[model samples]
Target: MAPKHQPLRTALIGLSSTAATSWASRAHLPNLLTEQGRSKFTITALQNSSVEAAQAAIKHYNLPPDTKAYGTPEDLANDPDIDVVICNTRVDKHFETVLPSIRAGKDVFIEWPIAQDLAHADELVEAARKSGSRVGIGLQRRWLPPVLKLKELIQGGSLGKVLTADVSFYNGEEDPTVLPEKLFYFTEKRYGGNPIVILGGHSLDYIFSVLGNLVPESISSQMQIRRPEVKLVDPATGKTIKTVTRDTPDILHFTARLQPSQYVVPGASFHYVFRSGQPFPGTPTANFTITLESGQIQLTAGSPPGLEFAGPGQEAKIKVWRRGSKEAEDVEWKWENVNDEIGPIAAAMQVPLYAFADGKEKGDGWVDIEDAREIARLIDGFYKKWEQDGGL
Candidate 1:
């Protein structure tokens, strides 16, 4: 474990009672409470929509008795002891929740899909830059052991020259006719909660991470919403609550051509196909295939949104096939033993925190807001293309 002079004081925004069962609680809090993480980070504050909620979160999570609880984001941001502000809110709340922290010169860690649109992302980047604040975005899949190994193999020429790559993700929520009450906002485009922005954004980030410096020369995309209206269903009882019209597209298909490919050296032609949708019958959650001149590499996970939420003990399933091989070979890579106590999501969440702390001490290790801006641009490109082709 890396030595730390003192634990970094941390504050959490949008951490409420509801978070106990949400992704933030499942993936982040447990990791932070681990022995290794406790050595690096100390939870000092909690912020919620109301003081009651914040206080409730503090009690629910068994935080330090002295941990401050604040109703407003500004109050938490201005706290002198907060060294890191972690925002795990809904997509639409990110901009407002984190802006004060950035302005106050506190390093921040925000979950993926930094903002609802490119413009908001650009603004956040600018603010962080102006304040000289270290910003970390939760594109944590890149830190997964399998993903790291894949990058090493590609860079080391294990796959020879790259030929083509294809990625398909199914979120398993395609039945727009039924959504949980918490997910009702996803049906509205204005909130930027659609699969295209959330799931597609992460998919693009992971793709770029594996390709390493490959820039797209051309992009073509199509987005469509197969179900115009969706019903709200009670998650526990599986009964419909109500029906509402949905404007956001549930399906996204895109193709990109990368320049300077391995086959052509400084100028090789590389192609990629990206597809995402709601959950469908007989469809795997996610699959990624990369074909090279000499061999092929493939990765699949049960839950498609991100590897971070992969099922327990099944973070990623990887396979490799060579030209002369009779069948594909399974690749075994285990996560660090220290992370074994937590679920896959919690294990992945620990990565960004480590990077954030390392970057604060050593000056380089985490993905910043600039990376978020790039992803936002990529997502915006799809929207623009869809507009040009007329709405589906």
Candidate 2:
């Protein structure tokens, strides 16, 4: 581990400037360049598809010239000076990219939907266990301000006993006939970055963030491949590049019965509905609410729904309406501690860095490897159920 005063020597893999939906650029780098982020960590190296690609990224990202560049995960893992590695590659690329780092006994953080499925996610979990390297997942939703405030309110008994939770998130798909060329694999089950796991998983993660007592003991599901054919288009341009099969779920619905908890009475239920290929019509992209014994709480996204993606100027508004109140009062919430320039989304990525630098294994919104495995495993069960239902 790096010393308390010294920054953690860090390495970033898959930090591409041209990739489709570059989360590495949007949700990660900005925070690492901040004053506090710099004090806590330093970029020692990078691992890209090739050595030349890594060098290109170094220049693109404006890191120090002395930064070493590697083409392979093993080569990056072999660098003893690199204390931590952050992987932001595609979901299918995650297992191969981070396994070496875990075996090398270096700390790691990988973006959500940890792997292709439960099998790969489990393998990473076991590797981290054997190597004893602390691992964190990009389940940064719990740290978002709206989620944090909801957590405080629910857990503090501000809403009384929780009875039921209902969540609805719509991708608001911009084009019904087109998908991004690079994202073709995202709609395939084989690649494991489909709407089911990415949107469904994050929805569950955020809801559980505020309502931990509602952890599903059992789930019943219904899913359908609503869009079987889609035009693969250039993201920057609307022109069609190709047409591909969209075999993944465009509509997913689930009902869960939670295990008993102090804050929730028995028979409490959670219902989730996700729809792709359709945009919300002048309404909050997400409409979520919790029904409590004495009152209720509601959350809606000003931007697109889900804590998995956050951009500048986006907001999640929380409102509370008690039994005695005439109307719901808005709950004022904001991420005050972080620099406003970085915004809440990218700033959430730094929470684990500081935790790891301080030698702690856990902190708010930090989902460890095992926690990540469970989410993947749970979502895997959804697929099995879908299969059992003949991919309805």
Top-lDDT structure, candidate number: 2
Spell out the clash pairs found in candidate 2: 172-279
Find the number of clashing residue pairs for candidate 2. Answer: 1
Model 1 quality (TM-score): 0.91
Q: Give each model's whole-structure lDDT.
A: 0.76, 0.80
For model 2, residues 31-115, the per-residue Cα lDDT tens digits are 7788887887898898999999999999998899999999999999999898889999999999999999999999899988899
What's the CA error at residue 372 for candidate 2, in Å? 1.2
Candidate 2 runs further than 4 Å off? 1-5, 213-217, 307-314, 337-340, 363-365
Q: Model 1, range 1-392, lDDT digits (tens) per residue?
A: 24334588888887677842386787788877888878878898888888889889899888988989888888888788888889888888899999999999988999888887778888898999899777788877777787887777678886687677777777755554678877888888778767778877777776777775445556666787677888888888988889898877777776665555554244333444344444355555777888887888988877765776666644578889999989999888877833456877778777777778755442134577787677888778877777777767
List the pairs of residues colliding in candidate 1.
Answer: 172-279, 173-279, 174-278, 174-279, 177-231, 261-268
